[model samples]
Target: MQLSRFTDYTLRVLFYVAMNNDRLSTLNEIADFYGISVEHLRKVVHALAKSGYLKTFRGKHGGIRLNRTPEDINVGAVVLQAEGAEPLIDCSGLDCTLSGVCNLQRALADAQRAFMQELNRHSLADMLDNTAMKQRLIGKAV
Candidate 1:
């Protein structure tokens, strides 16, 4: 299953912030680094701050920093928060007669649960543990 762009952006924002934990990062900087739109990043940043993943500062020298340590940020939890409680598939709209008899929904749900469980085993800090990879991606000498 493919994730929504919103969820994708949320994860990217988290990764970038986690990698630059040494200092506050600006939206423009991250936007330029990833070649993504600053406007879109603004929305993602706002949601992240509201969810307590980030602390946002206003005014001239304003920027954002992670509110919690990278080790405290769970990938699964973030995915859950970003995706909300929406079902992966809406079987109600289907015209198929096997909707009630089919076990596809159950199988999909189980797979989704397993996917989240695997992600839960890793944290943002674990993502940055690969120094060479982190440096290569974010251009930071972490």
Candidate 2:
């Protein structure tokens, strides 16, 4: 299953912040680095800050930073928070006759559970461990 652009951007923002944990990061810098729109990143950053994943500072020298340590941020938890608990497939609206008896929904549910369980095993720290990769992407000395 494909994740929404919102989820993707949320993860990207977290990764960038974790990589540049040495200092606060600005929306323009992050947006330019990833070649994404500042408007979209602004919304993602606002949501992240509201969710306590990030802390924002206002004014001329304002910027954003992670509120919690990288190790404390669970990848699975982030995905769940961004995507919510919505079903992969909404069978309620489907008019198929096998909706009641089909095992497809159950199988998909199980797979999704497994997917999240796997992600739960990793954290932002794990992602940040690839220092070279992070450096290349964010151009940070860290």
List TM-scores for all candidates, in order.
0.91, 0.93
Pairs of residues at least 3 apart in sequence or in different chains that clash in candidate 2: none
Candidate 2's residue-wise lDDT over 10-83, tens digit each?
A: 99999988887778899998888888999999999999999999999999988999999999999999999999
> Local distance difference test, per candidate?
0.86, 0.89
| Model 1 misplacement above 4 A | 93-95, 137-142
Query: CA lDDT of 80 in candidate 2?
Result: 92
Question: Tens digit of lDDT per residue, candidate 1, span 15-132?
Answer: 8888887787899988887789999999999999999999999999888989999999998899889888666766988898897899988888888888989989999888778878
Scored by lDDT, model 2 comes in at: 0.89
lDDT of model 1 at residue 76?
Answer: 87
Quality of model 1 by C-alpha lDDT: 0.86
